[model samples]
Target: MRLRGRKGIRESLEKQEDLVVLQPSLWKGRWSEYFGNSNPIHVELGMGKGKFISELSILHPDINYIGIDMYDELLRKASGKVRFRREEDGIGLDNIALALMNIQGIEDVFAPGELERIYLNFSDPWPKNKHARRRLTHPGFVNKYLSLLNARGEIHFKTDSRNLFEFSLNSFADLKLRMRAISLDLHSDGLREDLVPTEYELKFVSQGMPIYRCEVVVGQQSLEAHEIRLKQEGRV
Candidate 1:
């Protein structure tokens, strides 16, 4: 949900510059340098409220994380969560960074093969047929992700919308991408200890909602196609 514009949202975000990356595109292809480590990078597209990313970063110190959100209010709120975790748990926030940007401009921030994994948690379904292209799981975005992920990289997607889940699976199939660990009801077997829940996810689970999830692996053919397209467009 989009929060109302709050006063000083920009100032609040700026105050957390240590955790919030400003002018992130300049660091494109140099995320490891920015993190001061060569650890694999995992990014959450549209990380709402930052619950999942912050908790995941705290759980795994060896891997780096970047949470992207377009709204200033959301990023501010997410920054607050990271701060609270750092103060309350006495843990370092070196492995995590929050970026305020739209997902469509993601290519300007990360180079090809720069990401180890991408997370899609409760993304906007854009249920209308005309707006399907705007869905995060659309083939256009998936192809961009394919170009960005390393050979072993994968996309972990979760949503409460059945239509969107099915649509994403079909889109993957059309691209001949391999999918694994699909769950129609993610919590039907009870929540797994390793699973991290987002703020919306927690609320959905509380309401007894069935969550859909899947992992999409990059196929060689798809990767080659992305490369060939990039070359054809003179972007490579």
Candidate 2:
């Protein structure tokens, strides 16, 4: 969706040619060069309207963040938020960037061992069995994530759909991924104090819908095998 208000932010984003990567192939091996450092990188796929990523960037300025979304209309809104924060804070928030791209081409945008973490917030469930491949937790997408994630990289997922959560659990088990942290009802008062609530998570919780959350680690062996298979097939 097109962002409303903040015309100045829109203009600023228009001039920030280097901050937004429109080309997917160029992102494969140029992330460090683009960010000007080799600091840890984190990504949020399907960053809708920028609330979650923007807030996370503000919370953690030490690590670099990239918000990926294919819809230019929605990305423009996300861009406006990032630019506005940079202008208002005057803190040179250079750690954050936005990309107009799809998650299917994640490997094309990030080199091997590039990402430290990935966030999947409220992705479409694609509930039908025929559309299972489109689910973020599906084997196909998990393989794509394995291509760019570091050996111990973590994937954080939070969703309101029980079907998607169950499917993701099964997918991770089938893939033999080691899952450390798993929460079936994130809204419970017993939740860890360290948990950071995303925009969608907060809304869902307030509406009395229990959120599902989990963290999966990509082991060294799995990482190596994933890389070899991707290289052989030439896509992740």
Candidate 3:
């Protein structure tokens, strides 16, 4: 999922220093200080073109948002749309940040309990059974998310891939995680207020693909298990 050699991509990313974090590692555990607010942080993994998360920032100023992706080209495009008409306190989109990083390396950039919520919008289905673990909602990735989320944090996932969605549900159940908001035909559910359509989501919906959605929460048992893993990793 690499898109290189895009003209002005690097230049634009460099120019938007306030919006994009070239090196996110420096503020791994201290993101509150980076945003200069005690607001809870929410991150969108694989935020293609960044429209959904950017608009979410505007809607919820109390929650800081970060859009993470692997390509600077996409981030360059996202940086353009993420800008608001009048940023809060002239701080320049006060509650938003973009990071250039791979989804698999999320653990290296965000500490346990640092993120209040995570969004997986139209993630790669990774349809091959052998590559199932590579999917964001796979059991392995789910465990990583468990370690990253706060006590009450949850993951809001939306995708058009039926296999991926079903796999995610089964994975959450196997891990003893709490699941809610399970919807198959999202547009018909009358949960419009809760629906924030990503770029891919809109296209899929227009094509009549039933969008699958779910929210996975870290249950008490899973949280305790994650704590044990964190202690073993010396992260607790």
Per-model TM values vs. the true structure = 0.91, 0.83, 0.87
Between 1 and 3, whose lDDT is larger?
A: 1
lDDT of 2 by residue, 1-236 (tens): 33354445545556667567677568677777778888888999999878778767877888889989887667777877777776777766578888878788787778888888899989999989999999989999998887788865888898999999999999999998877558888768853457666667777777888889887878575467656776898875
lDDT of 3 by residue, 72-99 (tens): 8888878877875334335457899999
Q: State the displacement of the C-alpha of residue 192, model 2, in Å, after optimal TM-score superposition.
A: 6.7
The deviation in Å at residue 120 for candidate 3 is 0.6
Count of steric clashes across candidates, in order: 0, 0, 0
Ranking by lDDT: 1, 3, 2
Kindly indicate the candidate among 1 and 2 with the higher TM-score.
Answer: 1
lDDT by candidate, in order shown: 0.90, 0.80, 0.84
Clashing residue pairs found in predicted model 1: none
Error of 1 at 89 (Å): 1.5
How far does residue 123 in candidate 2 sit from its true spot (Å)? 0.7
In candidate 2, stretches whose alpha carbon ends up further than 4 angstroms from where it belongs are 1-14, 190-193, 220-236
Q: Which ten residues in a row have the lowest lDDT in candidate 2?
A: 1-10
Top candidate when judged by TM-score against the true structure: 1
